[model samples]
Target: MADEPKTPVPESPPAPAVAKKAAAAKPAATAAAAGNDAKLAGRTTTAAARRPKKAPADDDTSPLMGRRGWMGLAWGAFTAANAGCLAATGRFMFPNVLNEPPQQFTVGFPDDYGIGVDERFKDTQGVWIVRTESDYTHEAPGFYALFSICTHLGCTPNWLSAENKFKCPCHGSGFRPTGINFEGPAPRPLERTRIALAEDGQILVDKGQKFQEELGGWADQDSFLQT
Candidate 1:
């Protein structure tokens, strides 16, 4: 009778209540994880919003902000200021004034001039003092001044010591020692400047007052001074 082999025992199945509890706990865990992820995303968004933004590289609000531009501007200002100062200094040093030579000027005493044509005043006064024979033979000799300007075109003539005459370079005009034009396109003789005796007995030459030889003004008493 060994009998009938004992029947093998069957394994017990899991309880439905336990399975339900585990499934519910799985849903709770998934919701908790989703909430944590949402919190992290919110923190990340807040941090990004709080961060400071970077500025642009080429912020050219003003020209002086750039290195090269600032240097150039500064240099230009400096140069302009220096130029203004230099101009001001020049104006101060040389003020606006009439610098023309006086029309009436004094030479030296009458005794200083000699009996011959004096070239001393040729460069400075543009005149030649010529002591010639008196028109009145009995009277003392008189002095006359001959201008060096050319009669034609009003050009200045140069005295040629070798030729004993005045030659104009502009038109090749020639003049004698007595200011008489001998050659070239000279219309007439060189004119004479007026001369007078000052209160101090000094010789005064008035360039404004002229004497024309054709007009016989040279024979006037004021034209010649008695030596």
Candidate 2:
């Protein structure tokens, strides 16, 4: 058999070299992508770390008064209101009372007083015991109690021994020893209280029974005590 003429085989181009280059470029691209992802993850972490945190609620971080403090203040106000109401109720239940002196009282005996104005009971009993040799209106020797109040404006009169008169410091009203108005703004004579002798010989003065000279009440027998 004659040798067949051999055809020249074409040499394949460097496919392995091209494939290796492609493989190497793919790995580089993957590495570049990985680096970009790593950089993005780092940026995200930094941004998250830099962001501000949220604040607590108002009840937990209030600037003025805490929740417990506000509650305590409300309770204190309620207690004070209750106390005030209780005080008002108590005041309504029990009212105020005024203590006044007795209207009837006893002085000393007739012999203890001289034949002049006795001012011993003036400050304490609001009366002046006058023992007279003869009364101007009754025309008899007796003892009478004159109220120490002035007839002008109800002011207390001071007995002046040197002047022999009752002088009111308020309006300068003057009264005689017998309680007769003598000078200054007195509308009428002084009033007389009931004078009597007690069972024990003491002078019993009853302020509840009053006698006015202008009203002719001095003529009553109870207005004077005969010594």
Candidate 3:
């Protein structure tokens, strides 16, 4: 017995259509994920490229000096060496010379001296002006300039007024006031220098001309000044 008629049920979509839609959604999601991954990779590559590269720890480069600094040091050394060489050359070119006193000079007038040994010119002129009443070698009353140098070794002899002699301090050589060597190692009498009157009336002594008693040079007219 059919009591009532049953309601008709709605038909579901086809499995193929559902399957196609799901398949299309899956492909779109996969494509979106791939695009994001590609963007991230690109960003990472850009950042890495922008970063600076670091030098190796084993590098031999010096922090304090560069190539220019080394070159400057070499140039400075070269210049200093050249300067030293130039100085040596200059010293060789201009040799040293001795400065000696003039050979010819003039001492004062004859009236300024008295009889006996006058030591005024001993230290300065290297001569002793002796005014003798009678010279032993010349045998006359006049003035004679005796060289203060000893004949033995060229040492200077001092005049001792108390002893009335010229004594050589080096070897005990002795000479009378008349310039005659009497004791010690002296080979001859004290030599005399050229003595004359200048045009101005002042006595002029010339050390350039020497007179030796042994050689009869003391007999020369220039060796003695007759008062």
Candidate 4:
């Protein structure tokens, strides 16, 4: 018998059926692959969580002791102290100006005094106010101020009413009621200060401007003011 006739096997299913089965198998495979990827990602996340964390580093920065911070503070303090010292020195060197009384002062009215020597200003002003007659007849009267300072050593001479003269307690210098040095080491007569009348009817005495009989200053019209 010759080779049995090869029975042609039934033809495989159509390509469409095969394609459909393949498509169905592809979905299951893709599901399995996605599950495996999800598991791997979960494992990686667990490993990261199990790792030990690193310790924090120590901080070395200081707030006040920084390089320029402290240095700038010290410099500022030094400059402020120096400035205060300079200001104090300047104030001491050139102090504030003051207005003091002048050498000329008011001694009140002429009628306030008596006829003879007025010793009211002796201890206070170092001067004596004397109202005397120009002549022995006692007709023409004039007023004069006699400096109480002794001519010998610039000491104050006390008026001795008992002795009728002015006597120095320091050098024994004596002066008459008219301010004439009669005894002791006094070289000249006592000096007289300038006198003037103020607009307010007060007697103005200028102690800075004095008249000395030895220097012919008594002839000056400013030596005394006419009442």
Candidate 5:
């Protein structure tokens, strides 16, 4: 067998000029990258400086809520409570008039009820009676007999003699001497009654029927009492 000859390693060719130039520029490229990073960092810092800081809605040491806001909340609660209370109280307490109003009710002659103003008759039905001065003996024949119901509300009415009017106890409705509504929430006059003269010369009023705008209450002298 012939002795094996050893193969020698081939020598590398000389680097190209362009390749050497690229190697030399590596450091400059790295430096340029570092400079670009530095410039980016500076720009970031400038932008942060230009942006405004966020502030709080209220003073630094003050509470988040204001006094007015608290007071408004409190008043709203109170008003709601008051309204509930009133609604509860008005639920009951009024009984409608029952049975027929009393009849054959006696009243004094006009001599007693004249211009003097509301002389509550001396009878049970006349609990809150008001009489005006004017003798109905042989005069112009104008008279009235009415229930003391308030025109504005359902409360009982009272005769205000000094003021010469009938006034409601509830909401201040008023009426004239002839039972005519004159003031306050009254829409009409106090209802007048059906009247008659009894045998004993006493005036009797039928409280059942209500007559409005009558010049004179029922009065027949000769047929006063039953035959």
Candidate 6:
């Protein structure tokens, strides 16, 4: 019984097959681990790149302040407005200061107001009415009326019956009773109002419509009055 040659048994082919399968499985596991690691790195990078944000603060943006500044603006506007009002008032009141007070009003009932020829009446800041008996020519026995003020400085004028003229006490300005400025600073004759006859048989005169120193065109109607 010599040691028969222990047969060198042939290695099983199944062993190599098993080893190849395990090697393939190892590669898959390694690839999966690498993929997981890459994903984790991406997340870390993204988080690190982000920056923190800031919050808004409340700020005061108001215009209320400084009482003195506002007061100055108000005062300036008020003064300008006051000046404008005064100027406007002057425009309306100027006539009163520069012109004579309407007086010596005439109510033209030539017969009632008619006196003698060249008959003069003192018209000192008053209204007068005249009526004539005869149909005097525009210049004759007809009655005339006028404001008794010195046309120059608005002084009340007095009529002198004997002289048949007007005299202003303020400045010696003189005028013929017929309303002519003969010697005076007056630029023209006394003012005259619009005169007319009322249906009631009385003469009507409008003192408010005092015409300029010139004889009104209607003043020529003195020939038509009946007292």
Q: Whole-model Cα lDDT per candidate?
A: 0.79, 0.91, 0.88, 0.81, 0.62, 0.60
RMSD of each: 13.5, 15.8, 15.6, 21.4, 18.4, 21.2
What is candidate 3's lDDT per residue for 53-126, written digit by digit as tens? 98755433878887678889999999999999999999999869878776666778877878899998899889
Please give, for residues 131-156, the per-residue lDDT of candidate 5 as tens digits: 43342332334345666666566677
lDDT by residue for model 6 (1-227), tens: 78777878888778889999999999999999999898787465655568665667435343674566677889999999999999998899766556665532444344565364222443442643343444323543444446556789887877676786778888788876556688868788766556666676555555666655355443445323333
**Candidate 6: where is the Cα deviation over 4 Å?**
1-109, 116-125, 130-137, 213-227
Report residue 200 deviation for candidate 5 (angstroms): 1.8
TM-score of each candidate structure, all chains considered together: 0.57, 0.69, 0.66, 0.57, 0.42, 0.42
Looking at candidate 2, what is the lDDT of residue 97?
Answer: 80
Choose the strongest candidate by TM-score: 2
Writing each residue's lDDT as its tens digit, candidate 4 over 4-57 gives 778788888989999999999999999999998887873657667899998885
Number of backbone clashes in candidate 6: 18
TM-score of 5: 0.42
How far residue 165's Cα lies from its native spot in candidate 5, in Å, is 0.9
Deviating ranges (above 4 Å) for candidate 2: 1-63
In order of TM-score, best first, we have 2, 3, 1, 4, 5, 6
- Candidates ranked, most accurate by lDDT first: 2, 3, 4, 1, 5, 6
Where is model 4 more than 4 Å wrong at Cα? 1-88, 96-101, 135-140
lDDT of candidate 3 at residue 212, scale 0 to 100: 92
Q: Which stretches of candidate 5 lie over 4 Å from their true place?
A: 1-101, 109-113, 126-139, 214-227
Span of ten consecutive residues with least summed lDDT in model 4: 133-142
